[model samples]
Target: MHAAAATAFDATPIGSREAWGWRGRTLSRPVATASGEGWLRLVSAPADKACGKLWEGPQEAERLMPPAVPRPRLRKRLTWTEDEHGYLAELYDEVTAPTVTTHEPILREAPDLNDAWWEGLSTALDAIATVSSDRVAVRQEYLDRAMPQYLGIPIDTTVPAWTTAHGDLHWANLTSPSLSVLDWEGWGVAPAGYDAALLYSYSLLVPDTAAEIRRQLGHILDTPAGRFAELVVITELLQTTTRGDNLGLERALRARLAYLTEG
Candidate 1:
């Protein structure tokens, strides 16, 4: 639990504690003197059960992946068990791998707008798309029209078919100063475009760097492997509608409608 605490939250002194939430089921105690500095979260067993049920399949996928080369021996203090819960435990274990490692988040920071970064990212996406497409479902037409209006793409098809993906790949989950990606709760097979779209949409929050990334990836986006770009956008919009708050749902639904109408 100590390792988990240090990795998930900042290192600081614990302050006041509070018990709050629906049915008083959840308890959040502040671990830092200042707000957002530290947190000690205690969730009910029922909540854990619910999460376990929801992520069963993805958990299995994680198990199928080869175990870490150097077996991860650190034991988290939480009551969660892979044997009892099966799927959820395995899934959590796999996603948290990079965090457990001394060297994680494979990328230290967003690479400069250069060909090398572009090529590496593009290659990685391509490899993931090709190797995992059959197990994942790619949504093509939905994204093609949806993303272009917002992202101004050199877009086209020939992008690998969709596959199981992290579905939600944003800066928050991607990097913690190092290159290791954290938070694997939302991972699953989806269209190859899902991750790409996520990066693009997030880019809207940082236009300059996003545009440069797009430009660097221009060749791939313009050529055969462009379909995944569209898939990424549509999947995120769908996620917003199904899982987001009212405002987010509205925005996502509007985007979906607009994309459909464009054709």
Candidate 2:
């Protein structure tokens, strides 16, 4: 836990801590703040690695995204300097609902998602796609390189459209019973239908839920652009296997890749 960052925000940790993100670089917890009960996120990096689109994502989402989007509202921020490390603290409104999954990015069982919840999710993603941002979440250069290498897609493949996306839309980042999206640290411009495709990838382990995701988000996930977006996401997840992350999803991902590229 980042004690300095929490103290700077006038926040007192009240519950168990969650340490996640790249090698546990991000830590978050429920907190009691003078303003009200809130959630505090503490992100740290080596001094030289502290500046990037990802580092600025939460504040940028609060500034640019619409109110209709069900996400934690960023209320305050504190940045501090240490010897060779930097820490950033952000306080957000407490979301009563828990994530669909507590640990894994993929779901082992179907969540109790209703029509209204699905509708809200669709609407929120549509709204997010319309926001303007200079941040690049998925680069064309990466697509060009990774698609051929990971998915065996053509090197010259072109993405039909590009739009703003949550960038990381797996089960762990979404709330259940209510529709609050979490972790805006990677939101930015991506291939069109990227969020839906990413969600579909994470849902692959559960066939029924995967089918429902395809049905609910078919407008985006059942198109030429959507198909390409799935390949892009699959490429990314496949690449992550080199680091031994999401190993359970790798075989399923490769199967989907094969089905997508079947001629």
Candidate 3:
């Protein structure tokens, strides 16, 4: 998103201070959203397939997403300005409550999730799965091509199914208390288990939480396609770690891969 990963919470990207903060504290992370107001995102160009997906992601999500899902509505698409890396910075409005807690390092233990929260999240995902759009993207080829290089090993490139997904389904993008799936910039068609796998990978630091996600999404993740999608997600996080993201998750991710391959 930013010129470098270091620019996440601190950079106050040019032209985006109003959305993020003019005077914020120290931080790291490319995306930033004010609690009750708006958010700014780091993007590249329409030509860059990955950045292009990020740019169109929220708009498409706004159009196709079900009513119950919690997401920041796109109030407007601000003009893109060139960033330090020749990427672009865009801003939009936040829809959900400011009090909601995104599951980063905040949650010391699992929150007691009621049936409604689970149902809403699951139903929202189901609605996304039914959508059909090539404009809203994240193709299967990206995973297939990146896997060998990312994992430092070969893989079975057979993709059995594809569906709409919140491509970056991680702790930071998710909120507890009400189960809101934030950050639609990565929403698009992907291998079936991609979303579940991403959340699973992110939850690896907590065994009980990770087990709960697996149990809840077992129907989707138990299939061959889901397992492969989980592999793709693991490879991605592992790659991110290589660049200094989740340093603690590498060992857990490798263990997961071994378990998956064995199963």
Query: In candidate 1, what are the lDDT values of residues 106-153, reduced to their tens digit?
Result: 122444334544554565455444433234333456456645553344
lDDT of 2 by residue, 1-263 (tens): 36666777778888686646657788888889888898888898998888788789999999999987999999998877788988888889999899999877888898999999999999999999999989889998887777888776565568889999999998889998999999998899999999999999998999999999999999999999999899889999999887888899999999998888884
Candidate structures ordered by TM-score, highest first: 2, 3, 1
What residue runs in model 2 are displaced by over 4 Å at the alpha carbon?
17-22, 153-155
Question: Model 2: how far is 122 from its true place, Å?
Answer: 0.3
Per-residue lDDT of 131 in model 3:
78
Model 3 Cα lDDT, one tens digit per residue, 91-118:
4554343323332422235656666766
lDDT of 1: 0.42
Supply the TM-score for candidate 3.
0.73
Q: Give the CA lDDT, 0 to 100, for residue 128 in model 2.
A: 96
Q: What lDDT is reached at residue 156 by model 3?
A: 74
Candidate rank order under lDDT: 2, 3, 1
Model 2 TM-score relative to the real fold: 0.95
Top candidate when judged by lDDT against the true structure:
2
Residue 45 in model 3: shift from native, Å?
8.2
